[model samples]
Target chain A: MLLFLSFLAIIMIASSHNAESKVHEIAKLNNEVRELRTHFVDGKTELMRLKMESSIVKKMMQKGLKRPERPPRKIIVKN
Target chain B: MAVKEKNILNRLYFIAACMFVFAIAVLVKLVNIQFVEGDMYRQKGQERVFKTFDIPANRGNLYDSKGNLLATSVPKYDIRFDALAVNEKDFRAHIKPLCEALSKEFGKSVSYYDKIIRTARSNKNRYLLLRRNLGYSQYMRVKKFPLFEFGANRGGLIVEQRTVREHPIGKIAERTVGYERRDEQGYYTRVGLEGAYGPFLRGKEGKRKKQKIAKNQWKPIGDANEVEPQDGFDVVSTIDVNIQDIAHHELLAQLEKFEAEHGTVVVMETKTGEIKAISNLGRTKTGRYYEKLNYAVGESHEPGSTFKLMTIVAALEDKVIDSSHVVDTEDGKVKFYDRTVRDSKWGGYGKISMAKAFELSSNTAFAKIIDQNYKNNPRKFVDRLINMGLGETLGLAIKGEGKPKIPYPGDDDWYGTTLPWMAHGYGVAITPLQTLAFYNAIANDGEMVKPRFIKEVKTWDKTRERFDKEILNPTICSKETAKIAQEMMKNVVKRGTADNIRTDNFGIAGKTGTCWGNYGKDKEREYISSFAGYFPVDKPIYSCIVVIHRPNKKKGYYGSEVAAPVFKTIATKIYNDIPVIDEVSYAVVESNAVVNSYDKYYQNAQKYKTIMPNVKGMPAMDVVALLENMGLRVKLEGVGKVKNQSIKPGTKVKINQTVRLELS
Candidate 1:
């Protein structure tokens, strides 16, 4: 009975250590997710600034490109 | 000897009795401590092991109509250091390089950091702040710096992370995206859509019991939490980012050009009443413009000449006069009860039709007509406006909507001149949004739909609520009356005050409003210039309004000159984006001559694969593609149909042979 009790005690200690390590891993992953979200938001903001029409017009002005004055017309061909 | 022994026995009995009394006292004290103080001691011990931690839920993201992220929550970091953790030898070895790296990153002098760090080291400061609110990339760069690379033990690097709201579009629609904040008193101050939908955007917080296993590290005591946090639901607004960008920059340019105090622009979908773009820019003291306030939804002032549309519509609905009825302008000026109404034109448009009066935005004509017709019963005109829903609030989701004030006959501020003033859009207050809605009703064929901002609320892919077109009134007026009003507006742009904004590509129907602002109270009178209407006159898509306040008098102050240009810019942009599709009847016409030639070329290419075959009269582009795919490289010269080929079509197509084709 004494030997069986000691064996159970050892198993309990090992599982508790395993649980502790899992908690540490979860915390590390949570931090990584937070960092990734920050990077994504930063990149998105930069892209939006570049994609704005005003910015595009300003950039294209240097290349001597201007927006078309009138809308394009599509002619339908019947066969 | 017998006498001495009796004395010794008596002494021993006394000593034994005293020892027994002391033993009983010890037992009583032990029982008191075990029973009386046990509960308190047990509670104190539990306090050291168990803790309740708050799990914060992330605030939901804000998206535009096309699912472009407008606002989101992301973690920001603050970096600090413990000066005393570094020993003398390590500090001397790494401090120089560490200071150099930090100075390069922060753009400060190296000596500045060196001095501060040295002082902190001497003072043995445990917590020395290096930088606050660094983004993720900057924090990562700092972590790899000299001493900081060793982490918390040797380098004493301490990083604190907190979530903050970030707007992806920068300052484009910052005011509309807004934010929510709380004070120490637990009072929340919310603004814009963020404030209006705070309850939905701010998810519930959760709680969990945890045990401290190591330094600053906690382990949850159980598998399940006491309560689970639900992330906030996202709000999808109807604002189109492209339109918003155009409106913002256009308004900013006009404001800068005129040196105006402030201005606002609102574009609404005619049928659905969705606000596609709303911009409000106010000039700062430094001569820069920013979205200082939501003037489009919050500022209420006299609408000036733009209000003529409402007056004319009311008169037409009442059948007091037709569009062709002629009204004398009295050669520019007319007086009524200590107030004089003057037309901007010097000689005035004399004896013009009501439609022309409206087109010219003749103040004297409008004032004279309203005073003559509704003078006896002014309440009739006021009641007509109220019935049109012009006197009521729009009940917008955004906070701080300005209330519209329309005076009745029995009201305290009403006077004999109030009717005439109200006729030409004075002595009345309405927000830019309200005016847009009223004009949108005319554009929608008199179906007054309320202006909507948000389209749906969702959690990830699951939709919680979807907002649809909410009709404020089924019909604002009769179909005939609405048609007449629309035509009058069309004429205003076609040949009237707003003629400067007229376009040949598409038709615009709108009114120009220029009215004196803060007239009686201020020494110098200021003008508020505005333009409001819709485009493509027959079938409208958008109804827009542009209002600029207090433009420089020397540059120009007329609504047609200042505000109409912005309206035109936005209208032209929208017009130029949509392609014009020309439709034709699906009647087939047989061209036997071209078909026969095409068949002959196709048959020749397929008939002979190893021997040379005749090839002519095929288009140059088709011939190149066909020859290239069949393992023959073709070089074309000139343009149009293929006239001759250096090698015949079926010449045992050599693997590496180059065929030259001549075209005419």
Candidate 2:
């Protein structure tokens, strides 16, 4: 009878441990998806900024606008 | 001994019975766990492990009829935080650097970020939205931030994909196409073409079943449950982008030059009423062409002389007057009630043909004719106009088409003077498009057609569903009446009020309109000047209208002065750009010289001149008088009526060299 009680206790312990392992695994996957989302957000913002600038530059070119020429600079001492 | 043996046997049976009961109970419990109650635990297991997430599909792209991209959907992302994943003690310690990083990434203040984070954590929102519509790079930088370096799910940060609307054409036709807004009903609807055709423009939303592994953490189920989204169909518009650009540019220039309160330029294909270009420019309070009001469809003022075309058509249809029928224009003015209708000038034009009356825009002659024809029966004329499809909303695919208010004799708004006032364009309101459509019907051989903007709708690949033109009526007038009306309109551009619109390239025929607007705000009677016409009078292809509203005196307020030139400007370019059925040919009508006095002028300057005699310093009245006698056109231009001429005075010039005369 004592042996049977010991075996039943062993089974309960094993099942509870399995449940714990499962919770850990779910946490790990949750972390992965969250990390991926952050990466995606950063990439999107950079793309939008670049695209907006590119469109502006393209419009300027279409209007036949040229870059402004640099003027000669004179050296000055602190006054 | 016998009792002991019996007791042992009963104990054995009892033990067997107990064992059988235990075995049955165990079997029943296994069955319940394995089948009947299995789903409950399975659900519980899923709650512990699986997660669901939304996958936002891309918004559809909007394209022009020529497949030019007008609007499109670009992918964007939302940044979020999962407060439960990080330890509460460490959350505060890490919050400052995270806020600083987010501020730098989003270019917002650090305090704003800090406040959002503190509130989010306090609320215990597992996934709190930090910022939406972040670009890919911004999200990546946020992900790589030192405190957030731990992967998203582990570090309690998230980035979700979404789509943002973009206008590829920018503000071009922005008001017409319209926009989408989420209304109070929690439903999204389109405002313009974007709104009207939104169902066709917005692709169907896809669905997915996902498991929620942790609070606010979801992962998509098997591919079987994930539905692929169908993209929205594209709307192909009737608007030609090139022509639209030209109209926008030209209308802006005219409005600026005229310093007008507002203006609209509409170009429609004569046969189909397929609006090719519609440009509406309104001057801001600062007197600049930057207002967004759609004057073409919204403004419903008395169309004035432009509406005279309808009266004339009605007259021709009733056979009240023939093209050559002559009538004295009441010596310029006639008293009808307290209101006196005049032929523009106070004194009446001399004896003129019906065609000449149309050209000169004799208000007295038209009023007299309308009085004679409709005096006995007003309803027939009103019904005739209604049959021609005026005074009612066109029910165009676009919304907000205003209904015309036609005052009838018995109606509450009608008065005895309504006929005369309505005769010369008053006592009623009609939009620019409605007026154009009426003239368009006349030009289209009396066939009224529904004006359309969206020509075709398609999928991403051009599997087209072409929209056939809606022909509302076969003919509004008899073939004879139509021909007579066409000739009358032709006379308008040839020798009438709009004669200055004549170009060497194409023959134009239409009407000029000038009317007091904004309730005759000034006693001096400033006017809304407009010209509506179609080109190549022989086979009409394109009809256009140019309206300049409330121009200052410096800009020339007459329709013939301000609007006619804009019509010419646009028509000339269209004729040059688009191929027409017939090539322009000016058949030289040579006339026998009444006197050869100009022969010496041509003979002396023949060599120095490029081709023909340059009649510089010649009086325009005399030059036109002589040229019309000799069958030639005198292209006049400038302020004091014929200043310096383009060709040297008295220099022989080629017929092709445009003779520019300054005219005040």
Candidate 3:
């Protein structure tokens, strides 16, 4: 009986400790998610600013590219 | 021992009595504790362990019409240093390198950082703020630098993260893509699209119960939260980022060139009235320009000659005048009650048709026509404007749409001169967006649609709500009346004040409006130059308005100069945005002669080196190669294939000898 009680106590202690470690893991993962999200949005904002037409025009100016002066045309073919 | 056997039989009574008193006292104290103090102790134990916490849900993103992220919620970091966390030895060993890295990152001098850190250390300051609002990458870089590499406990690095709303396109459309903020009083201050859709953008908060465990960690007591948070639906606005970029820079360039105080431009689809792009810029005290306010939506000012379209439309609809009737301008000016109406041209337009009067935008001609026709029954004219929905607001999705003013006959401010002045667009006020809507109605063939900003609200792939084109007036006027107004505007651009902006690329029909701001005031005069119009006169696509206020007088303040050019620029760029597609069928050339001759040359050049292999009836080009590659000089004298060869097949060739090949 005494040995059985001792085993039960050991199991209780181990289980509580396991739960604690899981909590720590959750905290670490939460931090990681926040950091990763921050990184992703930063990259998205950078890409948007670069993709802007004004930014593109300014960059392409060094290569002598200008916005076209006239409207683009669409041609239809008849079979 | 019961008081030492109760002092024998005689003392036994006294000892029993004393024991009884002590037992009674102990029982009473136990009862008091069980009844009264139990609740207090239970409450104390509860306070030490468990807690209820709120879990915030992620706010939804704001996307442009094409799924480009306009605004989103992201974590920004603030870095602080705990001076007392690191030991003296560690701090001393890495302080110099740490200061150097910080100085390099923040662009401050190393000495400045060193001084501040040493002072903080001496003052025993634990939370010394290094930098605030750093991006994640910058925060990571700072963490990996020198002493900070050891992390929180040993490196004294402390980082605080906060979620903030971010706009990726920066300050270009900051006013339109606005923010929502809350103060301590729980009052929300909302602005722009974010403000307009605050409830939809901000998700619900979840509640959870947690138990305080060891090391300051709170372990969740249950597997599920008491309340589940629902993430906000993503709002997609009807904004084309390409067009928005074009409008913003074009408006900025014109504002800078004119040295204008402020300017605004709105580009709306003609049929649906969906706002494609809106840019509002105001000059700073230091002579720089940024988006200061949503002037296109909130500013209601007198729209000068652009209002002539409405006057003409109203007159035509009432049948008071025909387009062919001629009106005379008295020199350059005419008088109403104490006020004189004038034209921009000194020598009047003399005698011209009613359409020509509108094309010239003559103030005196419009004033005389409206006063002569509508002065007796002014209520009819006012009611006509009201029927056109001119006096009401646009009922925009966003807040603070400016109130349009059209003076009524019974109003306190209405005077005898009100009718004529209103005809010349002086005694009236309307926002740039309202003017664009009216012009857009004409472009849409008398269909007036409400200007819409948001397209839909979505949760992932599922659409929660979708917005459709809302027609305010199906037929604002007869189709012929809209047609006549359209023709008059077309002539305005084709031969009138705005003829300077006419282009052969695409037909732009617009009206120029120039009114002096603060006229007859003690302050210096300022010009409010504006142009309202639509493009591709035959099949209108987008209607736009450009308003520049307080442009320098000497730098050209006329509407044609200051505003029409901006309108033209935006219209041309947006028109070119449509991609040109031309179809061409793919064909494969079947010229085998070129390939065959090259193939033979390649083969013979390899086969014959020291001796000739076979050169019979081969092409002259191949024959020359067959002989020359064998170390013999060859001379060809024909355009066709080789008919005769001087050397026989497989004959051994001598170096530096000449061979003749004849071709047919």
Candidate 4:
């Protein structure tokens, strides 16, 4: 009976330690998720700023590309 | 001797009685502490080790209609230092390298960091701020610095993280996007979309119980929480980032050119009444511009000549006037009892049709049109405007829509002059958005749709609610009247006051208005230049409005000069930006070159086995395959069909011999 009690006690201790390790792992993962989110926001903000139309026009002006003065034509083919 | 012995025995008895009493007193105190004070001690011990915590739910993100981030809550890092965390020897050894790293990363002078650190160390400042509001990458870079990498207990690096609202688009629509804040008295200041959708964006918080395991560390006691957190749903607004960017820049350029006090522009989808872009800019004392307020939604002022559209629509629908009816300008000076109205031109336009009167925006013409036609029954004109939905607010999603006021026949401000003055857009008030809605209706074939900002509220893929087009009125005017108004507006750009802003890319039909504000002698009069219209005279898609207040009088201040250019640019750019689809017939036609090659390949495969077959003129591909199939290895040397072979042709079938065939 005494041996059985000690075995049960050992199982309880092992389980507690397992739980503690998981807690530490969760804390580390939470920190990593936050940092990744921060980096993602930074990249997205920069992309939106660069993709803005005004910025694109300014960039293309250096290469001599500008808005056309005339409207585009629609072509239709008859069979 | 017997008497002395007796006295000593008596003293011994007295001493024994005292010892017995002292022992009894000790037992009583022990029982008291164990039974009576035990509960208080146990409670104190429990209070130190266990706690209940409130876990905050993650706030939802705000997104544009194109699924781009408008506003979101992100973790911002503030780094602090514990000056005396390290011993004197360690501090001395690593201080120079630590300061050097900080200088390199943050672009501060080395002496700046050195002085601050030394001062902090001498003063024993436990919480010295190193950097505040560092982004994630910057925080990690600082964490990897030489001395700070040793961590909190030793190197004394402290980090405090909290969530803050961030706008990815910067200051483009900062005022319209807005935020929510709570004061010390627990009052929330809600502004714009965030404040409007607080219930959906702010989810329910959760709770959990934990036990203290180490200093400043708590271990959750169980896997399940007492209450689970519900994260906020993402809010998608109907703001096209591309259009917003163009509108913002175009308005800024015009405002800077005119050195205007303030300006506002709004572009809305005519069919659905979706506000695609809106920009409001105010000038600073130092000649800079920023999004100062939501003037498009909140500011109500007299719309000078743009109001003429409503007047014409009312008259045409009332069957009181037609485009062909001629109205004499009479030198462009017309009097209304006490006030005199004059045209901008010196000699005034000669007798012209009502259509010409509208295209030129003659104040006397419209004044005469409404005054003479409705003078007997002014109530008819006022009721016409009221029925057109111009005497009330738009009932917008965001708060603070300026109320539009249309004077009635018996109102306190009503006078004999009010009829003609109101004809020329005076003694009247309407928000810029309201005027755009009216124009948008004219573009939508008289179907008046309310302006909408939010497209939907959703969580991931499941939609909580969807917003559809809410029609305010079936028709603001008859189809015939709307057509006439559209044509006249197109004429305004084609050969009218706004001719300076004509573009070949698309047809812009609108009216230009330049009104004077603060006209009394006590204050200097300022010019409010505005243009209101829609584009593509054939089929209208979007209606836009631009209002610029108090432009410099020295430079041009007419609506044609200051405001119409912005309208034209926005319309032309938007028209050119729409993607066009081209169809290319993709029928597979068997070419002659392919068929000949296939026939050659088949003929070469039929014959030639285990013996030398004259393959000199044969294609390299056919030759290689023909030889290799008979248990020989094949190798190709060059490209396109085939050219030459290393071994003559087949010779004999070998188990593993490489045939180097060259291709042309």
- Which whole-number lDDT from 0 to 100 does residue B634 have in model 2? 63
DockQ of 2: 0.04
TM-scores of the models, in the order given: 0.87, 0.63, 0.85, 0.83
What is the interface root-mean-square deviation of candidate 1? 3.1
- The residue-by-residue lDDT of candidate 2 on B447-505, one tens digit each, is 88877888888876785678878887788787787777788888888888988877655
lDDT of 1 by residue, B1-664 (tens): 5679779999899898888888888877777767888788777777787888889888898888987788899888889889988777888999999999999999999999999898888898888899998988898899999989999989889888888898877787788878889899979888887888888889989888988788977778884658888889999998888889999999999999999999999999999999998899998999899989999999999999999989988998898989998999988999997888888999788898899999999999999999999999888888899999999989998999999999989888888889999999999999999999999999888899999999999998899999999999988888899999999899999999989999998999999999888778547989999999998788899999999999999999999999999999999987787788887768776799778867876775676555545557778766765676566778889998878989855457666568888899
Prediction 1 global C-alpha lDDT? 0.89
Per-residue alpha-carbon lDDT of candidate 3 for residues B202-298, written as tens digits (9 for 90 to 100): 9998888888989998878875548877788899998888889999999999999989999999999888888989999999999999999999999
Q: Model 3 Cα displacement at B579 (Å)?
A: 1.8
Q: How large is the i-RMS for each model, in angstroms?
A: 3.1, 21.7, 3.5, 4.2
Give candidate 3's root-mean-square deviation (CA, Å): 6.0
Please list the residue runs of candidate 3 whose C-alpha ends up more than 4 Å from where it truly belongs after superposition.
Answer: A1-22, A72-79, B1-48, B87-93, B122-124, B214-217, B223-225, B521-523, B582-664
Ranking of candidates on TM-score, top first: 1, 3, 4, 2
TM-score of only chain B in every candidate structure: 0.86, 0.69, 0.84, 0.82
Better by TM-score, candidate 3 or 1: 1
DockQ for every model comes to: 0.57, 0.04, 0.52, 0.34
Q: Candidate 4 lDDT, tens digit per residue, B526-580? A: 8899999998778788899999999999998899999999999989888887644
Q: Model 1 chain B, poorest ten-residue lDDT window?
A: B607-616
Number of the top candidate by DockQ? 1
Each model's backbone clash number? 0, 51, 0, 1
